[model samples]
Structure formats: structure tokens, C-alpha cells
Target: MPMLTDTIKEKLSSIQGLVFTEINNYPCIEVPKEKILEVAKKLRDECEIDQIRDVVGVDRFTKNDRFECIYNLYSHPLKIRIFLRVKLDSKNPEVESLCPVWSGANWMEREVYDMFGIIFLSHTDLRRIYMMDEYQYYPLRKDYPLMGLPGAVQLPKK
Candidate 1:
């Protein structure tokens, strides 16, 4: 059996500045900020990725200016999948949502935007999907500081 990672790396090595990563032990390709949409197109057509499984964002609060948009794609016929992760700086953690190519992405992208507070430029019908209107922070963001009920137990202090 051919190594999936090597095959993909060799095929995409020409996509300058592209990096490959492993997500949840699966093959993941990371494209440069400027090349996201282009790469997505290539992956869909030339690479035969027919399905957009999910679109979500990851918050790396430990690092300054750290955010990422992740796309999981697969092809039923080929039984192969690839993960595309696009890194964006916190100053402008925005990306062009590939809703045009994959209509299913419409809801997924909006949900990600709602949770990460990262704007997806050109994403049709971009709005708060899960949260109520005027909600301030992105709940899934690591920096959001998820906490339990306030003062669940009292502590004696001197």
C-alpha cells in the first residue's frame, strides 16, 4: 500500500509555502493564507475531493495572533480524505468561505464564525447561527475562558 502522506506531499509540494500537518492522526494540508481558495478549488476538481465534511475554526490563544480555519474533505469513490487548515493572524483572522463551491458549507461556515468570531469574507448568508443576537464573545474560543458556575462553594479567606 502506498503511503497517503507521501503521495499527497509530493503532489502538493509545488503549491509554494504550503505546509502539511497531521490532525487527529489524519493527513492534513495547510495552505498559505493567500492560497486558500485557490488550493480549495484544486483539491475539489483536480484532486477529486467531492465532499466538504466540515468547516470549523481553532483558537490558539497561547500564541499571539493565532487562529485557523480547518476544512475536512472526502471522496466517497476514492475513499480518501484530506484536511485543509488555513492559518490566520489574530489581527485579521478572516478567510474567504468556499460556499460557492460547496453549498453545504453555508451553514458550517456560519456556525464556525459564530463560535470563533472570525469573519468569513464572501460567505453568503453569514450570520449568527447558534447564539442569540448581540452575543459578545465566541464561546468556542480558547481565550474566551470557559468557567463553571460562579461561587459554587464558599471558601474562607483571611
Candidate 2:
């Protein structure tokens, strides 16, 4: 994949509170949670990022701001991809929804919410994608029990 052009780098750098860096040769931006929406908008409008490949959640189980959200974006025209990483508080993992900028982010965001318990604010239909609506536990968190929570959800008998 091609790296971000100097012009693109300049544009991205203009966004306040964004740290531009590269991971495995692909451009990655560390964005503050409060500036996520603004950065997403700039990427779409000014950078021509047309697709959001995926939204991934990470659980760094230690202390202080343990949750993170990584948004994988692709610019079809530029043939380049970039990652937007945002850290969230472990106590309340919530961030603005990118669905407003990329409609395709809907299900991706929901999946992150479903598995990681990270809430996407203003998401059109933020609900459990795999688990039942009443399900309380997030199965993918590092702290989740290996065997699963007892009586959290009853299985159907054959």
C-alpha cells in the first residue's frame, strides 16, 4: 500500500490533538476521544476517505484508560488506508459514532459495542449484534470469564 502523501499529512496534521505516526507502514493517527468526530469529518471531506474497513476494540487490562477503539479507513481513490486510534476510559468506554461520516460504520460499530462493551454515541441502532438484547456481559473482554459467566444466559435444551 502507498503511504500518505505530504499534502495529506499536512492536512491531517492541521487537526488539533492528532498525532500522526506509522504502524507496519500504514499511517495511524492517535486522536483524542473528544476530537474523534472532527477528525473523521476531516478525513472524509478533505482526505477523500470513502470506506471504513472496520472498527476494532482493544482491551488493555491494566489500569487507567484500558479501552481503545481503532477505526480502519480506506481511500479508494488514493489507494491508501489509515488507522484512527482513540483511547477510552475503562470505567466508561464511550466515543462519538463515525456512522455520521461513514454510513457503513453502522454494523461495524455495533459489533464493537457488542463484543467490547464500548458505546458509540449517536449510533443509529446501537444494539447487540450477536448476543441477545438482554445480555449483560461482553464476551470478548479480556477480563471475561474463560468458561463464561454462570447463568448469564441459559442455553436451549435439545
- TM, every model: 0.82, 0.93
Residue by residue across 41-109, what tens digits does model 2's lDDT show? 988999899999999899999698899999999999988888999999889899999998999999999
How many clashes does each candidate structure show, in the order listed? 0, 0
Candidate 1 residue runs with Cα over 4 Å from true position: 1-13, 147-158
- Output the number of the TM-score-best candidate: 2
Clashing residue pairs in candidate 2, if any?
none
- On lDDT, the leading prediction is 2
Model 2 score (lDDT): 0.89
* Residue 154, model 2: Cα distance from true site in angstroms: 3.3
Per-candidate local distance difference test: 0.79, 0.89
